[model samples]
Target: MVADVNVFVGQQRFLRLIDEETWATVPAVDPVWVDVPVTDYTVRNRPKRRNGQARTGSYQRRYGANPSGHPSGNLVTPLYGFVNEDLEISLAQLMMEWGFADHEVKFPRSKTAEWQYVGHDNDQRHLGLRVNTATLAGSEAGIVLTLELIGQSSVSFTGAASPPADRNKLVEFLFEDSTFTLGGTPLRVSQFQWSVQRNLDVIYHNSHNPISMPKTQFSETFSITPMKSNKTYDDLRDAFGMPELAGQLVLKGLHNGTGDTGNFTVLTIDFDRLSLIDSDESGGTGAIMNPLTFDVLKPDTADNGSAMTWTEAA
Candidate 1:
């Protein structure tokens, strides 16, 4: 199943925070592009068929076609595809440069408390999350960000058994049942909702001259959603190539809000205020670090396994 993952950002926030005139002149930040391969399989059963027949005789006669066995089982497979094209920023740089305190920033782990199922008929499933600095460390500079799949827990199906009939209900259940833990604490699933109307604001002012004629501020809100699969903690850890989950947030914008921008700007926005609203009530402080530095500790080249698949068995 494909996981419905959604990401959202405030566009005006960046524009309000940066110099309006210089906004266009800012160097473009290159996005980290990666292709994820998805696969799916299905099973179906066919009932036996009978033929018509008739017979007659002096006394009595009757004839009927023999029933055939069930048709041969078949497997339907497809290569599901997705692209991770989101502009990420560095949390640390944003805090220091933007003059905003850590308490003013909020990041989302998942879009909705509901999990998203992906596939031809909603049978396939996927999951995603917005990992920031807070997920990495309690209080320290050097640390790694990792996602762990504690284990498979029992999940209940309360929605309709047929497809398209219970789509909304299925979506709701998808997010409600899925849970995660950070630093040994189980965070509730309700903490993933975010405002879709918000944007990134950047305020640029002269440090020395307070009352200057040339005052500029830029604001722009960016939206980030799970494009394909809602990755688990293990999936994320594997993607970043870290032994443990502990890293900062990476903003993938630098080209004037256009993902097409061939350039990229990296900023680190620190997480000052954090709380656990999920099953694992775990919270802590986190900061943004250079991607190069983060990668040095954990290389980007890692194995991303096939997307998880599911099917109904007879």
Candidate 2:
């Protein structure tokens, strides 16, 4: 091939997932792949060098020339997309990575997502992958992956296959129609976002960036915008000094299906033992608002030892 001057576009990033036993490697066979609708993405696989230090702080800060490539900036690989098309596969992937699958099965139609730690981990839980190229897709020949984002084991993705037009519905959940509650009571709020932080630590058994990133510790946090009507006097006291572990968040999702709507999609997230991290009475404009932030943790065996539970209703 003589001097390939091929120019690629920004929207060429695509992804796919495949199951594997090893890390940083995919199967030789080209499996049937599906596309995961990734709205934003990034690729960074170049081996980052550990800067050598000078003896006794000799004012040394010189290094080799580091030139950046296209979409240049920080390194990133956490692709964001709505993994709701196949809730079964999506939550199953998370359960395998989290390693604590004590999910509640009360609701037959609704599926609860959580980690597991009793017997063996699911065989199809992890998908090992490697990152070496600084480009997404980049006109490469490969299939797409729709499997959920694997944390314990890395996400295995092939090349060049954008999400189907029908699959990529550019829609977001309406916040106004949704509901929020504190200990089951109504909470007049504006915005809310919660996240599970799996304190993952990379374990490399001599491989140059092995795909083993384990979630050693886990924690959850929640933040919500509350109006004056919702922020009561007791709520203010909870934010002072030492906060108490006495709150539960019951957040409801929207149902967007039309005909033949059986049960309707209702995503219910429940946090049993929630504590106020900080009270934000910053006094904002218009009705004077104060946002709320709280952290969550599972109680001991006395309370069943479950902090969070998310149910996906179909």
- Each prediction's TM-score versus the true structure: 0.17, 0.57
| Every candidate's CA RMSD | 26.4, 11.6
Q: Which stretches of candidate 1 lie over 4 Å from their true place?
A: 1-110, 120-133, 137-262, 269-314
Which one is best on TM-score? 2
lDDT of prediction 1: 0.22
Question: Top lDDT: which candidate number?
Answer: 2
- Among all windows of ten consecutive residues in candidate 1, which has the lowest summed lDDT? 11-20
TM-score for model 1?
0.17
Task: Tell me how candidate 2 scores on lDDT.
Answer: 0.39
Clashes of 2: 9
Q: Put down candidate 1 lDDT per residue, 177-286, tens digits, no spaces.
A: 23333334444322222111112221225321111111122111111112122335424444543333222222222222322233333323221112211111122343
